[model samples]
Target: MKISELYVYPIKSLRPTKITEGKLTKLGFRYDRRFMLLKVIPGENENGSGPTLKNMHIPEYPEMGLFQTEIEEAKGESEGDTSRLIVTYNPPSSSDTKDNTESSDSEDSQARRLEIPLEPETATLKPFTVTMHSSPTTGYDMGSRYNDWFSACFGYPVVLAYLGTNTRSVLGTLAPAKRNNESWWRIWKQELVLPSNGHGNKMLNQWLVPFSLGYLVLNAVSWCHGRIENGTSSPAVAIGVTALALTVLWTVVNILVNRRHEARIGFADCAPFLVISQTSVDDVSGRLDGGVEVDLTKFRPNVVVEGAEVAFEEDFWAELAVGSNGNAGAGKDSKVKLLLTGNCVRCQSLNVDFSTGKMGTGEAGSVLKKLMKDRRVDRGARFSPVFGRYSFLGGEGIGERIRVGDEVVVLRKGEEYTVTGKSASEAWNVILTTGY
Candidate 1:
């Protein structure tokens, strides 16, 4: 198959920016999901009166899709000159509105533009923590000025946060567990230290196992002494021993199941890359009433390939090599190789009609409903219909550049290859045996 399109979302849940070519980084495209918007409760604070920050998305705020983003390179000839991300607010005209009402004249008087430094001065920005899908990572607050812009657009309190130099790990269970020739024991040992880039807090993650093991040993010794001296086990001691044993067991299991998947992500929801076949989009469109052609942008794929002979054939692709030649045996020499980690789960965001800033009631809005009828195929995320495949950049292609029209080679395919939320060992084995 050949790649037909590529896209990146600088800010999570906002409009996607299509690119003719993109650089592969550990965290997807270079600028993909490097910033995000967080909803702030008016009277809330971190002291626990209420939530201080919450994630915003198109499902809750359909107008988010109307916010267009453009990247402008710096023109100044100075070392301090930096590119800027320009965001503009453009509401639909009266004819495009679902309610047939014109946008407010005042709101439309001028298209408001918010300019943000593509690479902000993180040293001066305040550190912030943002969580998604229970995975928390560090972010830098863009201060009151940027917050005010988003807050005014939504008519509520919100804050814009930059990912800065920090990196978030892929959901542990979804990450690949093994390297090409590494053993499980080696991976377990490596897990004791920080995986991915060293941006993760060492005190919080790296030392967890040592402290837990120490505590378990101390508790065991105390319980043994108490039993020997008293010649009887007290109820409290018995309970303590049971709890400690369970804790240690859980810790070890977590190290095995979660820690080995060391893939890092930025603000993107899951893997670094998401790919979909154009034929699959066409198939979904054909199923829609009146054959309404669904916009490929709605799926939000980082890579779109067009030469698949069958719809949904990507479901069987365990690994892919993207380069000038479509050869599965290209091995590490391939410029842009990808590991297909899992299926991309769908959400109600697909029903959003950007033109009207509301969920469409016609064929477009029913995309999710149609897929749910037969596309609930992934056992791991069964409730959500599968659309695209989530992927990670292969070790060989980390710094490579991938462009549109590149040949995509299916390196491996099998029925047992899909991620089912079980242990990652099976997936790792597939990667190793297939020479990924």
Candidate 2:
């Protein structure tokens, strides 16, 4: 397959900016999802302490897709002059015939534009914290002027925060906690011990402590029973047995959930790279009622490839290399190599039509519903439909550049097994065993 298109989202949830070439980094493209919008809740604080900054996305606010973004290069050859990120918002024209009397020139005058340096002065910006997918990370506030401009566009209070040198690990990528000058007991309580499933370790620590107390009480009762009648039937004995069983179960569950990897990411959702094929999109369009071709923008894929013989063939791709010539064996020395991690899951945001900046009404808006019938294929993310593949930089291709029309070589192809399936686990055992 050949690389057909490349894009970068300077701001999350906004329209993507197409590019001819892009520099690959640990966090996908050079300027992808480094900035995001957060809703500022007035007279409220998160956890009754810090600033109330809630994440905003296209799913919650469909009109956010209406905003357009562009990157303007620096003109002068000076160290102080940096490239600027330009964002523009054009209000939709009125649909009523009476309200359509406004001239096109007059409507253009109503458009709003905002520009800020792509690389901001981090020393002068204020440090701010915001939560994405329940994980809190640090960012720099872009001041009140930029905040006011975004607030006016949305007709509500919101702020733009930039991820400046702050990193958020992908889920299941955290290294084991180390005892660096910390107390032994503290480490045991926080890291060594396990909590129940679907709950934070710290939040469930309180309950575990009581189980420790039960252990002591059981020891005392056993001693008394041996000294008196040597009987095993006692209320304390029953409670101790139950507590011991539960503690063992919790430990097993924690071990299964705490699997880790070595990948890192920015504001992008699950992985650094999202890859999709043009043939797969064409297949989805054909399934629709009128065979209306849907725009790829709705999927928001960073890389688009063509020449796939079959639709959805990306589901079996494990490793890919981009270079001047498409050769799987030579991918180790290629310009860029990618490790396909998992299937990219879908959400309700796919129903939004960017052309009108609103939720679709006909078959276009019901894309998610149609995919649900047959595309809910990934066992790992069973509830969501699988579209593109999530990937990360691997091999010796870091800091390399990839361009459109580059040759894409598939180094490895996985078996026909869904993610989280037994066969899939066996197929990926090599990568997992090597901790790639």
Candidate 3:
């Protein structure tokens, strides 16, 4: 099956975009951990490097997109500053401007900038101290836990997983389809689900107390025309994947939408964009304030992983190589099919710091530099099951990758074979090993 849809969350609890392409990096993705989280430092010298992450109960920042942000590799190359992504957000408004006006005027802006309008609660930043990780290629070790930071406060480092044909096709047919209640806000608020309403612009600005990890459902639609959220799912709203996708999280009975009127959403009304960003395991790593998302200066993980069904779905790690690390040649697209027997779960992010062999806590100790600067998980850790708690392939949930375009070969052993999707470097993603 090809990728039907893709999604990414720039901030933890806010809405996200349905993106098509992104940059993959060892810290996760290039701009993945660019921004970070912050707690109000009670009168300290230079924020004590910002945020007192000393095992504080503050789970995450709900709103972290209001302020400004930037990252510079040299601080002077671009605009006399290092090469880095600058972030900022707008406050919430009841007017239709946030919905209709701004969107109409910015169609040309998205080409040169990532203008995701969101609310914020606090703000703090660093010049070039961010680190990241991304992808599910062949050699990527899964169990290595490396503390991750991000563009916003998020629970995991995520990439958009999409099957364009499926997602777009569903919107085409599901009309005259059924649906549950349209009270999406109440449902999501109660379920603690994040909103992927369409254009990936939902942001949270308050505290998520008694907070539990929540996620939006990104399903692999079989027939976009037939699989409508309120049509087949949402009978009670709190059902399994149905409610999850539409942000319906109430404990009501499942309710299907009456197949009478076809509620069509125009590409302009709610275009999908993926907010691909990194996340750390610390409770404080995924919170929002006003709109800014920050890291608690003290948290760290071992390994980081990025997975996608549309592009990097098969033979991911195997098909991938760092920009300057190897032959640096593009790959061909191929496909390998496998049976996913378990229930479909769409929310998963991996981050660990095997750097010290122990997943350390608290800002009591700090790694002033980036995660790559740490020698523990990066070099000292062994590539064993105990350490690679997560692997690029051959494990639970994380199936193997298969190319799916053109220009390629077929390798096999026993009942296994390989597939490629493209022949160009710009699109080449991964390589996969088949089993059965």
Q: What do the candidate models score in CA lDDT, each in turn?
A: 0.75, 0.72, 0.23
Candidate 3, residue 28: CA error in Å?
2.8
For residues 223-264, could you state the per-residue lDDT of candidate 1 as single tens digits? 766775786877677667767776887687666645444678
Among residues 3 or more apart in sequence or in different chains, the pairs in candidate 2 whose N, CA or C atoms overlap within 3 Å are none
Q: Which candidate should be chosen as best, given lDDT against the real structure?
A: 1
Candidate 3 residue runs with Cα over 4 Å from true position: 4-18, 41-51, 54-60, 64-88, 94-436
Q: What TM-score goes with each of the models? A: 0.74, 0.72, 0.23
What RMSD does each model have against the real structure? 10.7, 13.8, 26.2
Which candidate, 2 or 3, has the higher TM-score? 2
Error of 2 at 280 (Å): 0.3
Q: Model 3's lDDT to the true fold? A: 0.23
lDDT of 3 by residue, 19-134 (tens): 34333321222333222232333344454663322111112222332323333233343532333333333333445554444454366333223432121111221122111111
Candidate 2 on 1-436: residue-level lDDT in tens?
8899998989988988899888788788888888999888776574787557777778777878779999876777852358888998866666673443666855554458888787888899999776555446799999998999899888899989999767775653211121013343444344434433235675455567647656755776566556446555465765566567667766764454342223567787656788999999999899878768788877888899888999999988878988853344335567477777676667777888776778887998998888888887877556667788878875345566788888888998878633644433332232221111
What 10-residue stretch in candidate 3 is worst by lDDT? 427-436
Error of 3 at 273 (Å): 17
